[model samples]
Target: MADPLLVVPVREGTATVSLRLFRTATGDRTAVAFSSPLALARVLGPGQRWIRLSAPALRHMVADLGVTGIVLDPAGTLPPRSPATGHDVHRLRVA
Candidate 1:
């Protein structure tokens, strides 16, 4: 059977958007995916932007980047709240 597509979280950079990888408690690099949008939202929140990719595709895309694992339907763990409340800026620098 063909690999099924999964919901993968992504983030935007200064000039391009890319997959958002994760680190385990022990500092292992991993790519997180979800079986469905609902599952993704449950962990990453409703406003998370994502794209569809099969597990195999994700593995290939991240292989060169040192990502060694894929986490499906990861447990939701909200980051500790920061006293500061604002969005971080992302801008491209010109040489």
Candidate 2:
């Protein structure tokens, strides 16, 4: 059988990162989870941005996927808020 391909950032037209759970005794793939880096980190860390993974998931990912690295993407979809604009504000100023 062919090995599964791994990718980061998960480009729009490409496959997303996948986590394959494995059984310790036989080293077989038992389950798979897929998501964007942001989504995965959100799940792993919950409401907190920086947190350590529980021993179990970390072990499973390492054993099953042979993963040794993770890279954070810098792009974010949400735009920053802009300053309020209106001519009425200037007119409302007191002399």
lDDT of 2 by residue, 1-95 (tens): 54333222111214543332222223322322223435534333232122234334544555645533332222222221123531111101011
Q: List the residue pairs that clash in candidate 2.
A: none
Give the per-residue lDDT digits (tens) of candidate 1, residues 6-53: 999887657987887777655677778889999878776787779999
RMSD of each: 8.9, 20.1
lDDT of 2: 0.29
Best by TM-score: 1
- Predictions in order: lDDT: 0.72, 0.29
TM-score of 2: 0.19
Residue runs of model 1 more than 4 Å from their true location after superposition: 80-95
Which residues of candidate 2, in runs, are more than 4 Å off?
Answer: 1-29, 46-95
